[model samples]
Target: MAKKKNKKASPNTIGTNKQARRLYEILETFEAGISLLGTEVKSLRGGHVSFKDGYVSFHDGSAFLVGVHIAPYEQTGQYDQHDPERRRRLLLHKHEIDVLQSKVDQRGLTVVPMKMYFSRGKVKVQIGLGRGKNVHSKKQDLKDRDIQRDTQRQLASYK
Candidate 1:
């Protein structure tokens, strides 16, 4: 009889853009593959990524991820490492890109990167179509979140 190989448990999520959620009202989300170099992939696996100010831009009928930072892999030589803040190409179908571009152009909405995760051994990005929220709405969202947290705490205590 052959022995079974043990599989290690690991989380699929690499990082999330919490600021994007707090600043924008997300309307729709689409999953797309990100083009990354080897060192970038290693850094992502170690959770060394920042999504601050990350957004998607359409150019010549293709979408690109911008403003995101993937830290350089420390174990690799300097020359072998990838840029920490380079624009990455996103793999989306032509029709999907067209739809997002149309929404951005016609509705004045923004395309932001919501999260990045590994799916079936491939890295995937979750992009959201969002409208920028005003200061008052952001404050309201904070208040509502606090209220919901308090209610959940009270319910848990009662139980």
Candidate 2:
């Protein structure tokens, strides 16, 4: 018998933060380029990225991604290994960065990384500006989701 290979040709999405939608009300979204090391990119391609605590922050007139974890590539040598928790710089137009900064400062909003994916062979991140949802609103959203699910099941049964 021949051994099987589990490797996929290519994956569309690298990672996603599922809690972003449930914890915050997204106001705006922007696509930004991420600066990654060679090994980090390989790790991402292998589905080893995490976004649970990832967020975007501005410093020195530039944007940086914080808390996003990319596991080191398994084949990398010890001398060339990259830090999993190092802050990565984000590439965006100066005007966009200014706008994001102003909105975040004035409205007390947060910038969170919603998803990471490959676009034309380049890694990109979808950043969302969001306002934290309160407990009551979260409950309402859960209730609405349940109702929609129940309606979908009913419609399916009727058909």
lDDT scores of the candidates, listed in order: 0.93, 0.94
Residue pairs whose backbone atoms clash in candidate 1: none
Q: Write the per-residue lDDT of candidate 1 for residues 35-147, one digit (tens) a residue.
A: 99999999988989899878999999999999999989999997898989899999999999999999999999999999899999999999999999999999999899999
Error at 52, model 1, angstroms? 0.9
Clash pairs detected, candidate 2 = none
lDDT of 2 by residue, 1-159 (tens): 999874444367888889999999999999999999999999998889889799999999999999999999999899999999999999999999999999999999999999989999999999999999999999999999999999999999999
Q: What TM-score would each prediction reach against the true structure?
A: 0.89, 0.92
Candidate that scores best on lDDT: 2
TM-score of decoy 2: 0.92
